[model samples]
Target: MQRLLRRARIPPVRTAPARTAPARTATVRTATVRTRSAAAGTAPLGLLYERHGEPAAVVQLKNLEVPKLGDCDVHVKMLAAPINPADINMIQGTYPLLSPLPAVGGNEGVGEVQEVGRRVAALKPGDWVIPADSGLGTWRTRGVFPEEMLLKVPSDIPVLCAATLSVNPCTAFRVLADFESLAPGDSVIQNAANSGVGQAVIQIARASGIKTINVVRDRPDLPKLVERLMGLGADHVVTEEMLRKPEMKYIFKSTPRPRLALNCVGGKSTTDMLRHLQPKGTMVTYGGMAKQPVMVPVVSHIPQSAFIFRDVRLRGFWMTQWRREHAQDREGVVAMMDALCQLIRGGQLTAPACTEVPLQDYRTALEASMKPFVSSKQILLL
Candidate 1:
């Protein structure tokens, strides 16, 4: 795995700061099915980063060498992967789960099982799969990986759905299930309402007969965003300012107060949503997009104390940690995936709005993902 080597057809190597030893141990054997890549027949190329900083600056497209396949290894021909905020954070070394330097930069993607080692059982040729854990270095043309790191998914779903499924959707599913037991007609509120997780939450909640109060920052194109989210089953889409206003009471005239508040944006945005929560409601803090400390009002303005008066519960959720604690419940994970796929097949859930870019054009995609008011997810088509 540490060898500075490439396949026989690969061109001579050049000195580069991002250059690292080729990954895994594998020699490609003659196979009946090959991945769709114009750049195939040459060494595999991946987005490699030598240091932690801005992802666009330190990452480079470089040739790779996969080592010989072990009996439990699976050779996957990469397909499509999304450029998620977590991926950017991991590249910058701010994310809790970071790959080693000179490592591939993707954390999630779907790929074809072009070949599986003799001992591989659950997956076979042509099976579409995604990584079960992070740090598999998904932003590459192909790679050989241990079988345990992969999870097979149905191919009938759209490519974008399978590619993006392993992260945001899964997170949404867990958050809804693990938190307050929300029933049909019950409502939940969330900020950053157009994010990948937010979109997933809207759809999943709708499928379960729950209503969602979606909140987003006021942007120039607010109407369009609200329309799109409402089309995806949002019961109400309000700007942060609108949520703060006294007129917010009218939003609850038709539906009940939310017992669950999903706060991805910390600071006042969280407080805005928190104020709307039903007494004893649970607020789950996930991502701090606003980059500010949460300010909860405990003064008599609310007619009672914030924490002691309302008895609102504050908690945090990290998907990686959930997976770790539930390691023994592999069956539970599979069942969740199966339920999500069923939702996809029934047309109850669809892929998030996506812009597919070929692997070589990653820089453009990464830049777009970092911009404000961005709704479409950037997917790299390998």
Candidate 2:
């Protein structure tokens, strides 16, 4: 099992040769100006939204004064931030947790510590860090945050990986670790297998010697996507249509019956996945991408039958609630980050495919993020 996990590792990083003077000059000039501004106490540029509505309609680029550092504050220079679906939902006033109006427009990203207040002890000027909680407004070039609201991460991880480490990867880890007491060779099934969280589950489960049966929506490029996920250690990749077929039962002949089922799309997609779960198995629902309530007929209601006869259990997980429950245990949060970082450093994990856009091109990035069936993540590079 350990050897299988190591065999699935990503290739080693490669360094690029130095660029020519013309290319290098622009980068050097920009760094010099940014450094001078930090020294002179100039305000940084931020994407601000005064009202909740469409992103392109409400979000604006503004030069806002940096807040005065508190006794335990740390000032950070933002590096990269990903445009997640949750960010879009929050901007549209639909997410479960909404920030007050006139707030900054991002929730996740990584930044470099540019300055630290006298009372700050765990962080220094060069340490890389991410927000310990949401609503730090990460879409800006710089920010000043309370020391307790940030978590330090190692500097060697790739910028994209660090910027995106918190939400999707952490969600995947918590669901897999907390719900089922999975052992080596235990099989798990999930839908929306092309999503960021789904991809993370595949790799993480593989590293733990657990098998995954991934189901994705069929698309024109279905073969390509299936190949891509298979390369990432997915034991089996099937379309939603395939999952509903009678022959799906043959899958268990090769591997053990799935003891854990993960549901992101709630409707028939979830129902189909549930049919394959072993007796007394558990299913954790984290999302409802289908935007439809999970319903089962009275005569064949699997939830009722499974509960009464098989002892099947159903539960829901929300990362925000978990964080709130564990708020006082700062050490526990740090330990989770450490474990995820070690996977990245060991080449056992990598960020989802990403497309980098400059902060000024945010409108384009936002549009790209909302497109149907878009696979690559759009990241805003500060």
Candidate 3:
């Protein structure tokens, strides 16, 4: 990274002798001044939303002030940020984490360190980094952030991988490993099987030798979606209807009853997956794409044995909350990222299907992100 940065660095211009300016010298100095102003004089452009509403209606592209660098600050040139469901929810005033009005509207992205303040030690110019937590206002061209707020990542990983890493993939990995004591050959089930976190769950589970029963809403392109999940190492893929049918038993024949059920789509989808968990199993809810409450019966709605005797556990996770709990544990975050990076390097992990859209074309990206059955993640290139 340092070598590449050295090669790309523009040589400093030599000053002409201090004297009365000739036409050519005057032109040179004026041009130099303009170049410097362009590089550092202006504020950066960002996607800002002044009032909470539909993301498309409220979010606007505007110039944002370049904050003064503090002794512990790191100046960064953002490379890319993804349009996530949480980002949309934050814009719509639905999510728990909302910045003040006129807030820049992104929570996840990767950036290149341009310069470091005097007291900043760990991060240097040319390093790749991501926000250590959410609500950092990442949908901008540049920023001056404190060193502790940024996590330095390996420069070799793909920008899209680094940009989209902190949220979904981390969520997936944590839920899979944290909630249950899953081992090789143990089965896990999840709804919204094609989402960013779901896809990460599939890959990470596959890498760990745990089987996954992926559930998705039925669509005309079911075969194609199933094929895509299969290619990502899913053990099985089924529709919401299929999950409710008697034949769900047939799936457990190959893999054991799942000990962990991951619920992203709440309502019936959550309850249905819960029915299949092994005795003393766990169900972790992290999202509600269905805009419905998780309905669980007190009595025998699920298989009476599973409900009465199964001892099923239910829990919830919020990445922002997790970040807050780990606020001072930056080393722990770095260690987790290091493990994820190792998987990335070994091809055990990969980014979701992403559609790169330039920052100026954010409307197109935001629109596509809300459309039904859209699988590819929308990434805004800065």
**TM-score top scorer:** 1
RMSD of model 1 against the true structure: 11.6
**Which of the two, 1 or 2, has more lDDT?**
1
lDDT of 2: 0.80
lDDT of each: 0.81, 0.80, 0.81
> What is the lDDT for 288 in model 2?
92
TM-score of structure candidate 1: 0.89
Write model 1 residue lDDT over 1-382, tens digit each, in one string: 0010111121121112222324552221111212224455578778888788997798887777776788999999999999988889888877766665667878889999988999999999999999887778889888988888889999999999999999998888767776676778899999998999999999988988899999999999899998999999999999999998999999999989999999999998977888899999988887899889877778667643568789897877877666656666677677678878878888888899999898889999889989988999999999
Cα RMSD for candidates in order: 11.6, 11.0, 14.4
* lDDT of each residue in 1-382, candidate 3, tens digit only: 1121122231111112223323331100000000012343266778888788999899887776676788988989999999999889888987765666667888899999999999999999999999887778889888888787789999999899999999998888668766766678898999999999999999988877889999999888889999999999999999999999999889888889999899998998877887888778988888899989987655764464445667887778777666766677676666668768877888878999999999999999999999999999999999
Tens-digit lDDT track of model 2 for 1-382: 2332234331111112222323221100001111123322356887778788999999887776677787898989999999998889878887777676677777789999999999999999999998787777889898788898888999999999999998988888777777677778999999988888999889888878899999999899999999999998999999999998888878888879899899998998877776788888988888999998764333456444665666777777767666656678686677677778878888777898799999999999999999988889999998
